[model samples]
Target chain A: MTETVEGLSINLATVRQQWGFAEAVEGCLRHGIHAIAPWRDQIAAIGLDQAARIVREEGLQVTGLCRGGFFPASDAAGRRAAIDDNRRAVEEAAALRADCLVLVVGGLPAGSRDIAGARAMVVEGIAAVLPDAVAAGVPLAIEPLHPMYAADRACVNTLSQALDICDALDPPQTGALGVALDVYHCWWDPELEAQALRAGPKRLMAHHICDWLVPTRDMLTDRGMMGDGVIDLPAIRRMVEAGGFSGPQEVEIFSAEHWWKKPGDEVLATCVERFRTVC
Target chain B: MTETVEGLSINLATVRQQWGFAEAVEGCLRHGIHAIAPWRDQIAAIGLDQAARIVREEGLQVTGLCRGGFFPASDAAGRRAAIDDNRRAVEEAAALRADCLVLVVGGLPAGSRDIAGARAMVVEGIAAVLPDAVAAGVPLAIEPLHPMYAADRACVNTLSQALDICDALDPPQTGALGVALDVYHCWWDPELEAQALRAGPKRLMAHHICDWLVPTRDMLTDRGMMGDGVIDLPAIRRMVEAGGFSGPQEVEIFSAEHWWKKPGDEVLATCVERFRTVC
Candidate 1:
């Protein structure tokens, strides 16, 4: 299929506040959207079997599980906990038959100034959980967040850095590990297009779509809708397609005060419209 | 002269809310510190010629001017106005016998999200004014801001990006253009040490120091003083020194609520104390 983005999926975080998992899924189906990426919390709320059954019954493609990262901590015990959680997440992805488990590699450890050290912890944590993920047949996709999140959110904040970690851990360029390229996080990077090309096929995993809002009000939540913001979507999509990534451009807006307040059906319809026209 | 931090200067914007330029100078002199950097507004308020004379009379070194960036705008007239104002800033730097004109390359033009294009505009803006700066012996210090400011502040957000621009414009690695490596901006980067090393002596125009607060309250203004936040100053300073940068670590905090409320002399004294112990 040429994939004109009409077949594009929406990550339910785009309308998280308006609907629970079941409601959001129903909303997607109502709008002729048949694929989605759901956050872990959403899956838990709907129950794993039900969520999985919904997918099988409706033939909805589970593009990716919302997360399976945050792999950094102050101590071994905390890191082990993260790893354990990641294992569970991988199992969930397997149950849902998700395309991949997206990872948001964590930021600095508590009371620590060493970002490099935190990064090391992330690597070690991922290595600890890699076997479990591989056993579950769930692909792990490291999502590089915006650099602003380096302190509190995820330190893997560039496509190059995330790909570097993937290369380090999966040296033979195995399909087990890859990167989830999000346009909002990397739209400003000068080496972005080059890095996307470097990602190639085996290492290119999931693609998330959102726009970077100018004068962003909240550091964490104020994400603009696809066409409303300044990202050249077609331009980035072209780069990804050239890299042979034909997956969904999952609409993963973290807009707490905007889209979250709209009707779920309305939000899904808008996402579909934007995906067809702008994305 | 083995330039220990005893020779390191403090840019009072780090503490300007706490002190005027005159008071800051007096305080630095009290601490046996003889070098400082001041913002343009401070000079305007205290009178520019008088600010120049104070530096001459007190034998204080003005390491570099605080700023002269903000290149992107909604329209050509606005951009032209910014460039014209930048030319004036270069003149002011020359007048003060400052070492360089620090440029915080501006972010997206209003209502636009093309960061690559914004970066292009920055290079063009600098090229437009480079001749005047060169003629006046004022090197342009490209201060790559933290990525958090990519939307409203400077879009040049990494040492490598800044160095790339410098390479493009000043291919010979001349003293005409370089970078102001603030530890806060580049600390999270895995490539920081290498990039700083790559910057080398000639291209290392300025070295601004401040701690990266963990919470980082407000995106624009909430900077922490040395030892009060999480960045390992001595480690980065080691990298800069290893890279052959022999300039003073100019303290440049932008704490709107904290240091801004303290007495001018107290803030200067704290800066000196922090410089001795932490920086």
Candidate 2:
């Protein structure tokens, strides 16, 4: 029963525990979801050419290639290595014809407490990969992670901060650099609305949806489905839409204990139902 | 060995697992720490009069009361109850002659996703208790919890947001309404330095210190000791000091797994050692 659902996408990580690349895509198709965002490892597993072939043949909308950023390092060699890897990610994103190459910029260097230094490295790393991304016709979407992940994941923890990076690098709003707004990471931000408005259509690249569970069991993977947690999804969606992004709202959940243990078919069905009603 | 430490104050919660109010005070005194912050329950357990007597007799500087804010409620009656309780907290602070009545303004109302509404409720609740606080000569210090706790603990999640509330309620930068800056909650903020500068001395009521451990085991009670985590404590202290706040740097740790299970004397010794060296 494949009935196309508009303005809806599934981030493969949501059902990562239940299915592989091919299986997840098949599951999404079964659920009438045509848009998707796939992690680099998943793409690697199926081979990028095969993934691209599948994407092209099925006419699937590759919302984003997740991800390519870990800029900060203890040394210059490590930084250069990260930039080199990001460039490869850009090429893969280009092959997939994705809307953007999501960048979860790295946090503080190993055993280092200097967040400012890490941020500077992120900018430099992005600048290094900008030309490659531009040549490949891929936009770099800086996904600012939640502040809880400031120590290890992504140091860019606010939309304002991400936008500031964009404004600094791509002053003309060329769409080469933008931000991925995830409600799970950004719903609590005081400046969310203002920052969304500031992002506008040109810089607001992607909109990811997931609920913030009240007791959030695991910091890494304890996301709740839409309508299951406390995030005001419609409100955030309104903010993103108002900012000019008319893209599919990508469902990205990383529930290690609950959803991950469920069957892929059930997860997809639930996502579709929730997307239709709550989201 | 009671050589008084001039600028170190202990928030009794660091030793909450091992000692109650009087014993915690005695522990602090033994460590040559003459200042302490006590939770309302701790004060109540020891009888407020007796707690006040101990502070007065021992010449212990009550740095700040542990808390007095949980504004947002599902109903108007609940909000009124919170305000009434805050008034009592003000009286208690006044009796203790503490520096300020720290307010951990609460999060979303049950079954509701209205963060803005919760924040508004916080402001209204604070306003309702402001007159009593002023009359009792107990300054209100709004402590913004980390964004992770924005769901169940506090909706006010940034120094900028807390300051905005203070500014709206008391435009004159009155010492009566201020912010309690905690490194654990705000170390990742990009506007931290700017906000600290903006707070200056008048608006900066309390300075709480603790480390943000990597792989934080529990969101509520897994804080690290001074030198154990990645937080740049000295750098943060420099910012606060530059903001014209020369008050004691109050050590507050909620380590359920590690520090809480240790001996109170060991924790005090480690705190003093870390405060002198790392902080």
Candidate 3:
């Protein structure tokens, strides 16, 4: 009989402070979590070859690679370098057999106030990488980060905006480009449900799960666990499912003060419990 | 000869830490700023009658009232109380002959995770008060706060969203139901220019100015002065002006640690200087 952890994927960042790539894989196995999304740095620490070996041997599912975007740069050379790096990211995701390569398309360039210009650079950068991504058989998932990160993190801050990019690039919903919809980033949007429906299964490449704490202390690392915050995880899940995405809900918390300090086992166990209950 | 501070208004909250309503007015005058926006608490501290007297005597242009909208409530009684409070706010704005009454619509009620419900409550709440607002001749400016405040402060987080509400309530683009376009709250919106154009002069009740700091220390307070951060203020001003709003750009910085600690004169002087230059 094949043992499978259905509908749950632990994003390695959830226990980043407590475990390395190998340790996290082991921890997830112990908790019966058979799927995961991992950051590039985590893959590098274990070596891409070793990570791929582990995934293959254990029959583990790589939900999505953490990222490959940050395309905005002040100079052409810098922008070219970003595109080159993104191509490498595509190779890694292809190696891991990831569902998609998640893209956190970058925010404003240094000393630049032209957000529209920055956004244009993101689209151009993504287009440059799309051919490489398609050739590698790795779908690119544009993760629309929370608007608060619009200044320093990602310029693409809405599902509607991400879909617009996908339509611009792919045009035919070819599954070559899609969006990684995280509840934390998108739950507050009034058009979220409509956008999710518009994305459907074809464009909804990944479904990331996390909560938005009421008094979110740190913008970068204060994300809440499944049931701890204001986000209605089950409701968001329903919307994604209605949109035809029946994939594992990836748990991607970046809690610097709380979850990061806990034991890796404890974190995995909590995620499993929440996945079964609240999520 | 009559003197007017053209294209400038000091939201008293900028100098709130150092001056009360009366003193803030004096400080603005000292800096040659004739227009001002004051919070309800500041007006209460000096008595509304007294505040009105000062506004009348000094020939001050009351640009806007600080706030008047916290409509979401778990129970009908609580919601009713909010509506009553909003009515009082309308009366206060009327008494002061202010340009508009800015509404920071409430977020989710306690222990509630339904943002959609909260949003519905916001529209209903606004609709409930529209009659009172119209009766008092006090235009209600629905200020779409940043998405960071969507969970606690305001659910309306986009110009498009706010305009949708305005269209729902008053489809004819009446000046009574409009929006206060604050750069600090809305500078990141993808459709800002389009929405500004949609708002035009009639729906653009007020124009607010401030900057967004990159590594924002606090979600509530750490707003930057005009030139201190990444927002393209002059570009935004041009958009607003193109939309036909040529009102004084109200400077509303909520920098608790920085501007709040400065002397009132210095804060006002800085506001004037930045307003003239960066803004």
- Measured by lDDT, the strongest candidate is 2
lDDT of 3 by residue, B1-279 (tens): 435558799999888899999888888887788999999999999999999999999998999997999999999999999999999999999999999999999999999998899999999999999999999999999999999999899999999999999999999877999999999988888989999999989999899988999889999899999999999999999999999998999999899999999898888888878877887
Off by over 4 Å in 3: A1-3, B1-4
Per-prediction TM-score to the true structure, in the order listed: 0.95, 0.99, 0.98
Q: Per-model TM-score of chain A alone?
A: 0.96, 0.99, 0.98
Which lDDT values do the candidates have, in the order given?
Answer: 0.86, 0.95, 0.93
- Best candidate, DockQ-wise? 2
| Cα lDDT tens digits for candidate 1, B119-199 | 888998999999899999999999998877887789899999999999999999878999999888887777898998999
Decoy 3 TM-score against native = 0.98
lDDT of 3 at B58: 91
Per-residue lDDT of A38-129 in model 2, one digit per residue for the tens? 99999999999999999999999999999999999999999999999999999999999999999999999989999999999999999999
Off by over 4 Å in 1: A1-5, B1-5, B74-76
DockQ agreement of candidate 2 with the native complex: 0.91
DockQ of each: 0.66, 0.91, 0.86
- Candidate 2 segments exceeding 4 Å error: none
Q: List model 2 lDDT by residue over B33-92, tens digit each.
A: 999999999999999999999999999998899799999999999999999999999999
The lowest-lDDT stretch of 10 consecutive residues in candidate 2 chain A is: A1-10
Backbone clash pairs for candidate 3 read none
Better TM-score candidate (1, 3): 3
